[model samples]
Target: MIIQKVSDAVSIKRSVESGTEEQRSVVKAIIDDVRTRGDEAVKEYTEKFDRTSLSSYLVSAEEVEEAYERVDAELVDIIREAAANIQSFHEKQLHNSWMTTEKNGTILGQKITPLDSVGVYVPGGLAAYPSSVLMNVLPAKVAGVERIVMVSPPGQNGKLPAAVLVAAKEAGVKEIYKVGGAQAIAALAYGTDTIKPVDKIVGPGNIYVALAKREVFGDVDIDMIAGPSEIAILADSTARANEVAADLLSQAEHDERACSVLVTTSETLAEEVASEVLRQLEELPRKEIASKSIQDFGAIYVANSMDEAINTINQLAPEHLEIIVENAMGYIGQIKHAGAIFIGRFSPEPVGDYFAGPNHVLPTNGTARFSSPLNVEDFQKKSSLIVYSEQALRENKDKIAAFARLEGLEAHARAVEERFKS
Candidate 1:
């Protein structure tokens, strides 16, 4: 890892990767075909990309049972516990429809309603991501979304990952489909013979999946167009070099484009962590990926002061910010623009990624400056409520009409005015 001054933090430039024109053309064609041909197009694309052909895309109960048999009992127990944690955490985010009436007999408030249905797309057919299942589904379930559908590509043997199946089942998803890629997103957005269209779609996928989501955005809602994983640690002299190095590599191992940075006031700590990162890279299973990430996007910045270091972190607006300083909590108020904030050495990035209660699906590529982690609100919609009494309408008709006329909406003005006509 190379070191630089905090002010000159140029190596870790963040940019969202839009697919090539060829990839976009392919994704658009797949979406259009699926919209027109429905299940037939989905099946063709699934066979082409996933190497699996399915008579019906829906996963059978027998297949789910088989998945449980493949996974260890202890691991199932763990998945259940994690789901419970996720559910409990998101339950706090739930809000009820509320209305307030004033003395003037006017009712004004907001009605909170959960989406009728949601589709969650889990990536990779051969590998399992039980955590992704729990993270994507549990919040929607907690928000009272009745129909939660899951879609993942199946492997060559026409079987989805056993652990992914177990996780979906554990997360209270009654509907699971073995279809993926741009076709799966299109099916979710536009409905098919076997699969029903959902109000919104959430979860991460490959470039084709991302582009399909981008294409179908107007017809249905989607989660963020997630960039590569990122972690920026704001550490001081008290932070451990090996632990800091390990946390940085945790994100780096995710993808070659994944970014890992450490901003520290201590130059010595910066040097030690850079060396430790290289030493630890050799032992990781995804050594090549991590090494390249560390080489290309990773950085160790030496800040002159704690304030400067904190400012650097805020400027980066990292997806995951770990304050590994001695008093991490005290500086949290000053540090803003992070998708998720992890305090102290004990609270690493993976803690929230896996077993921790918070949603790991977060804004990436400096989008944290505006966006937030996935939560219950994303699964619900709010409609403004207004019940104006006859007297109230008579009193506010002039103001309302004037406001509408100000916007050059004469029809809107007339509609409100006619409601109050003698």
Candidate 2:
């Protein structure tokens, strides 16, 4: 990892803008093909990319039942435990439609309605993540989504992973599909003859999936435009170098493009953490991926003061921010933007990724400044409710008509006027 002083803003921008031209063109072509060809296109891509031919996209109930038996009993129990925690956390976010009426018969309030149907895309290949199944589906279920459709790429042998099936069953998914990648996203967004269209789609995938989701945003609501996973650790003199290095590597191992950064006031701590990262990298199974991630995207920014370190973190808007300083709580208010904040030495990013109740599907790149983690609210919509009595309309009609006419909307003025004519 490169160590740099926190004074060069131009270098920071260049370092972070890692997007490529090829990614854009590939995603555009896939999206267009899926939009035009629908189910046939999805199947072709599935066969070509995943190397699996499917007569049907939907995973059968028997497959799910068999998956339950194939998975170890102990692991199934653990999935159940994790599912319970996820369900409990999201239940707290449940909201009811409400209205307030006055004596004058004016009713005004907001109505919260769950989406009719939702689709979740789970990546396959080496990036099969069952934890994503729990994070995406449980919230939709809690929000009372009528139908929950899941899509994942099949392995070379043409079967869904047992763990993925088990998690889907535990989270109460309505259906599961074997199709994956941008084609799967298209099948969910535009709806083929086989797959029903969904109101919203959520979950994470590779660049193709991300770009497909971005392209399909207007057709169906999506969770967010997620980028590669990233972590930024804010450590101080009190933080253990080994612990900080391990946490950084946890996200780094995700992909070659994933970013792992450390910001600290202590130069000694930074040097020690860098050395520890090198030592640990040699033992990791995905060391090649982690090494490239650290060598290219990773950095240790040496700030002159703790306040400067906090400011630098805000600017980066990392997906995960760990404050391993002496008084982690004291610096909580200083953090303005982060998908999730882990405080103190013991809290690592992986805890939230797997066992923690909070959703792990977080905003990546620099999107944490505006986007948020996936939750029940993402599966719900709010509609404004307004009921005006004849008398209420009579009282406000002139004002409403005048405002509309001022805006050059004569039809709006006439509509308001006609309401009170009788």
Candidate 3:
């Protein structure tokens, strides 16, 4: 990892990627084909990309049970516990539909309603992200979204991972499809012969999948276009070098474009963490990938003071941030950005990623400046509730008409005034 002065944050601003023209053209063609030919197009693309052929895409209950058998019983138990934790956390975020009556007899409030349906696309390739299954599905379940459908690319053998199946079963997902890539996104956005279109789509995928999500966004809601994973650790001299290095590497192993950076007040700690990162990178299973990530995007900044370090972090607006300073809790109010904040050394980024109960689906790039993590609210719609008494409407009708007229909406003004005329 290279060391730099904190003023050099320009180099660390961001590197969000948009798909190439070729990729976008490919995604558009697939989405159009899926819209035109439906299930047939999905299967054709699945065979081309995943090298698997299937008469049916839905995973059967029998196959789910078989998946449980293939996966270790102990891991299944862990998935259940993780699901429970996620459910419990999101349940706290749930708000009921409410209405309130004022002294004037006007009833007003907001109605909270879950989406009619949702589709979650899980990427399948070098690894199985059962955690993603739990993360995406459990929140929708907690928000009371019905018909949560899951789709993942099947292996060359035409099977989703046992752990993924087990996780979905545990998360209460009834519909699982063996389709992925841009085609799956298309099927989810527009109804296919087999897959019903959903109100919203959420999950992470490759550039093709990301582009597909972007293309279909106006028709159906989507989670943000997730860029590579990012972790920014703000440490002080009190922070342990090895632990900081390890936490940074955790995100690096996710992708070659993943970013890991450390901003610290202590010069010695900066040098030590830089050394520790390289030393630990040698031991990672995804060393080649992590090494490249660290080499290309990782850095250490020696700030003149802790305040400078914190300011630099806010400017970056990282997706995941860890404050390992001496008085970490005291700095919470000062943090203006970050999708998720891990305070102190005890709470590593992975804790929130898996067992800790926060959604791992977060805004990437500098979007944390204005966006948020996936939550129960994302799966629910808010409708303004109004039960206007005749007296209340009578009092406000003129003002409402005048306001509408000010906007040059004559019909809107008449709509409000008509209630009062004669």
RMSD of each: 1.4, 1.9, 1.2
Q: Which of 1 and 3 is ahead in TM-score? A: 3
**Cα lDDT of all candidates, in order?**
0.91, 0.88, 0.93
Clash pairs of candidate 1? Answer: none
TM-score of each: 0.97, 0.95, 0.98
For candidate 2, which ten residues in a row score worst on lDDT?
9-18
Regions of model 2 farther than 4 Å from truth: 8-26
Put down candidate 2 lDDT per residue, 330-421, tens digits, no spaces: 99999999999999888898889888789998888778899888999999999999999988888888999999999999999999898656
Sorted on lDDT, highest at the top, how do the candidates line up? Answer: 3, 1, 2
lDDT of 3 by residue, 1-422 (tens): 88899876576845566978998999999999999999989989999999989989999999999999999989999999988998899899999999899877899999999999999999899899999999999999999998999999999998999999999999999999999999999999999989999999999999999999999999999988999999999999999999999999999999999989899999899899989998999898999999989988888998998789889999889999999998899999999999999999899999999998889999889899999999999999999998989989888998998999999999999998888789
Best by lDDT: 3
Q: Model 1 misses residue 186 by how many Å?
A: 0.9
Q: Candidate 2: lDDT of 194?
A: 90
Evaluate model 3: give its lDDT. 0.93
lDDT (C-alpha) at residue 325 in model 1: 90
lDDT of 2 at 221: 93
Q: In model 1, where do residues sit more than 4 Å from their true spots? A: 417-421
Clashes per prediction? Answer: 0, 0, 0
